[model samples]
Target chain A: MTDAPAPGRGWVAVVGLGPGDPRYLTPSAAAILAEAEDLIGYFPYVARVPERPGLVRHASDNRVEVERAAHALALAAAGRRVAVVSGGDPGVFAMAAALFEALEAGDPAWRRLTITVEPGITAMLAAAARVGAPLGGDFCAISLSDNLKPWEVVTARLEAVLRAGLVVALYNPISRARPWQLGAALRLAAEHRGSETPVVLARAVGRDDESVRVLPLAEAADAPADMATLVIIGAESTRLIPREGATPYVYTPRSVEAAR
Target chain B: MTDAPAPGRGWVAVVGLGPGDPRYLTPSAAAILAEAEDLIGYFPYVARVPERPGLVRHASDNRVEVERAAHALALAAAGRRVAVVSGGDPGVFAMAAALFEALEAGDPAWRRLTITVEPGITAMLAAAARVGAPLGGDFCAISLSDNLKPWEVVTARLEAVLRAGLVVALYNPISRARPWQLGAALRLAAEHRGSETPVVLARAVGRDDESVRVLPLAEAADAPADMATLVIIGAESTRLIPREGATPYVYTPRSVEAAR
Candidate 1:
């Protein structure tokens, strides 16, 4: 067989940097970043990456995901390996959705580019791990961002997931302009689950100021949650395991009987 | 501030290597491995690490978790920085559990050991990320191994998580000797969720020959799942999005319209 003609040059790897720490970055993500000539991502997220030689950084505003996606596509079309980075798992409420949308809608040249979304330790996973194994069953992630969607629709899905007994990982649960939605979400969740189904509030996970609190579902609504917090609502079998000399953590499906 | 202990000694960062691939290893994990003088883990998992000098390897069998934990604790207790490794995220179904269990049960002399479990990409997280984000909402993770716990208790937790309407990430769902339990899990999930809720069967995630299939919950009982497969039961809003070049993926909340 004839030798392959360099196997189509334009390729992009959408890497997820995880929540707030550099340590959670996947090895493949680092490898791809080290090789890529250009990197595109949100401003705050872009700032997280260390300055490297020969790397061109293109930081964009939060609302400019579409433009960022276009820039990545343009770089890839120019035969440069471009990386569109996101803080958490790129596929979940991050860059992949916008990238795919922009790529599909924009120039035809990008259609030939190979796009790969390199996974990262998402905030939810990091938060869940820090507390306990609450993500131990049927769960769904919902974003409370109504900028692109309607509030009614969001509540409907939330209600369905809640009513169906799926554990919920709420992203964009509360932003500066959208504080009320979180309360609405908690109410929806409480309508189905008991007021006491463990709710883990994790803030700045894997970061210096990391704080974790295992509270009831009702109390979670009143907590000081911000953009950095990832809320994990446990299922019915969740229990508070009190470890000596350590902060209390919530573990789901406790095996007390099995251990005995 | 007491100088933070000179940046090295008494600091042990035990990491998870994930399922079975070097690529699955996170950058932080690689960094820890690169710095570790003595690396400890299960035998099969220890063999998975790339060959390197300046590192000592401690391999144990399935029955020696407590011993391994004690050994690592001893080394740390003696001020020797060590890396206690495990397959999958250390915090999820791996060394972290055993480490904490040993800590809770061991003599008080070892109680002061400063042990940190650096989370790796768990098999279920890797699997869920590979699929279309089935873990977007409230989800639960359960292990089917009755080795440590009774099957009756496991089943109860499964049913509890199911009734809570959370997505389920099943670990140890099946094995060579125990295959029927997964079917039972599927049946239980189907009882709570609609027949159309997506169920992803991901096997050997992040490794060569990784296979991912999306089916309805009703059909999950007959899906080609095994011990290696991580079964993810999607939430009610999870939809199957089919693309030409890309494989069909399960996307939960179905974009902004449903996200709202």
Candidate 2:
């Protein structure tokens, strides 16, 4: 770095840190972070960024995304190089949308500021990799947390996607406030798919303690899960191959029969 | 460097190179590529890896994924440290599924070999980042190609997802053999949603010549697209903001009304 970013010309980059592993962080995001003078995000996500000289960190609570986003924009509007970092791909149920929601409702000047959204390896992709290619075909990702949307809407979308027979990746499967949503979601899935359908439960993927398990849909409602867990409910074509000494391989074939 | 890898003990790692940018390749994937003795993939993807003295490249034509996968498996079974590389994510309509298809149908002994699938920044994610957080809410991905699946199934899945009002990310939208599919998909989406719905077209994201544009669903069917393009059809809540001298930002709000 030669000279510091000048005042009155700040920009904001909403970047993803990629699940929980530094190794999954894109070099593009890393370079941007290296040049950022300020970082803004939720407390734990902000804590993930290493502290350094001349860089300020703004940590806020989880549900206050709009407030935090407005703060980031106000800083950037004053010409501070800023980055709003998220644990996974910011565009996928992360900070990018929140930032945009704030931007559209905030000052029009914020719209003129340079903004970039950087992609990352989201948790579902990381989870799918640890298992086999369970999402090789058509797929959809739905968040089980009804904090933003009504629970009825969540189930409606879930049932619609399930009936379509697309492989589904469920995020925020279970949290403190919502203990039984995953079970309900699983039961709903089993109604449209076969009982022997493969359900991939992946927790903390890309972390040291990552756990990925594939079970039949019949047995998944009672499976353990947490807020960080990502569940992939496979289509009818999804298959599981039991390995002799390792976890089974689950994959959805690229081809489907004409009869379907 | 350490001694050469011994025969009969070599393993295969299916890894993604991300979407055309070296910076998008995760450190985990880079490390794996660095250790690979043999790289197998489509010609374009295989050519992306820089040639070295000890590294062997096995590039083949497109549509030969299964053949290429079997070749990789045979090579790995002979104790060659092989990497089945795919552009974007290997698990998303890429090599990982093909490799598994071959594994299950190939020799029984191949199941014992250790296999690892490394995730990458897929094209849809990269494309979404280049534009805006069009995928901020629930979303689904569908391939337009009918090579493996029938066109009826493609439309059936497309209509199902569109009826659910989730953001739809269309991959392999158009190609030589399937030049008219993207238009068909846009038309199908228009049937389920308003013609004024936002459609984000991102081409070759993360590449030097990347192009991202936001338009209405009415204009997207005629919009220029190719195999490298990814089209995201927004839901009812998707909003677009026009900037003074830049492309419009498109994003779906995180929340849905209770009435929805």
Candidate 3:
């Protein structure tokens, strides 16, 4: 076994915790968490890691990603093993960007610390798996929350993706702060796709409260989605095939021959 | 522990092996593989798993995905626990779609058999993690090969994604059979994005041969990319930050204030 690193040689790992399911966590991520001397993230994500004697958890409120990233960078620069955890894959609208931002603007010495990103099962992947691979072909993931980008940007991207005839996955589709965004997105999608286009709403995927619903685009605006939900709008060739005595399976075929 | 199902109650699982690294495999995938009575996939992917007693391996040529999928489905229908393996996340231009296609056209009783898809770390996610988080914002994943779709469809989707100002990840960017596709795609992207926009090419990610190169979009066409490569064209907000003694880190900021 390798010994602990020498002082001033600390490293930081930005890890995805994988949608609230320990089983969904990759072995590489779990190993990194086990070796971490400090864990930093938003309160709910940080709390997911069990308490340990040598591990110091730095939990903060949401919307403070920059501050948390800076703290993790500082700890790593000082020779501590740090893990900055995010609920889904860190590179997908998570802490990975924040860490890179801090690294870019921080002191030059901060760049000396070793950093590695461990990919986890992102929410879209988990949700797709649950609903029978609705993202089986070309797809785009767009976050509907206007907290970071302007509403115009989101709308433009949504329209472009829809017109391109690619499956679309919407994250943060509806939040307490952005209640009407999902409806607006649905309306925008309806302009490009037919009313019969399939939409899958997967909430709290891989968790005890997990629920999945499949509906046509016409009725998708009424889906019970919130901050924890992922909305997948199917492509033109997407199919909802019914199974005997089981919920229908949704999938976008590999070939585009059936697409308009 | 749950007992194994009797004859005629077998199941099928489409599993992603995760971009060539066993460590990138999820525990759920590993567990499913351990219980698999038959393993079926393309030759290279099937060779990735070790041999064991009472386990049969079915390896086939690369382009016969439909035939291979049908074979796996037939095995599962015959009461065998079958696993269909793919290199990246099976849902993304992989075996998941093929399996679903086979299920859609096969015997109706085939739908009665259980099927589970275990998501593995997809190549784009692994590549994005390797080069920091260039996919931090909204992004689209498109397969550059035209084997399954018309060339016009790929070009149209590429242009749309570029115009939408979202990061674009191109899988199957180049192969010996299709060497001109990447250059054609680069030309199309150049028409939309600035010459200085960053492009990241990650080859054989999560393996010993892994290499990540970040360059301006103008020079992206010259980068060495093959079937194993994933090319990420950054959005307007993507930044490449240099370190004193190491390669620069590339990332797209979470906010879209800098996006065009």
Question: What share of the reference contacts survives in each candidate?
Answer: 0.27, 0.90, 0.83
DockQ score, prediction 2: 0.85
Chain A TM-score for candidate 3 is 0.95
Identify the candidate with maximal lDDT. 2
Assess each model's interface with DockQ, reporting 2 decimals per model.
0.25, 0.85, 0.74
Question: What are the TM values for chain B, all candidates?
Answer: 0.85, 0.97, 0.95
Q: What would the per-residue lDDT of candidate 2 be over residues B1-260, giving only the tens digit for each residue? A: 46466667788999999999999999999999999999999988999998888999889999999998899888888888999999999999899999999999998988988889999999889988887799999999998889999998888888888877799999989998888889988998888899899998898887888888888999999989988888899998999988887888888999988753
Q: What is the lDDT of residue B256 in candidate 1?
A: 42
From the highest TM-score down, the ranking of the candidates is 2, 3, 1
Judge candidate 1 at residue B161 and give its lDDT: 60
- Provide the interface RMSD of candidate 1 in angstroms, 1 decimal place: 5.3
In terms of TM-score, which candidate is strongest? 2
State the lDDT of candidate 3 residue by residue for B137-226, as single tens digits: 999999998999999899989999999999999999999999999999988999998999999999999888888888899999988889
Candidate 3 or 1, higher DockQ: 3
Q: Per-model C-alpha lDDT, please?
A: 0.72, 0.91, 0.89
TM-scores, one per candidate: 0.75, 0.97, 0.96
Q: Chain B TM-score, candidate 2? A: 0.97
Arrange candidates, best DockQ first: 2, 3, 1
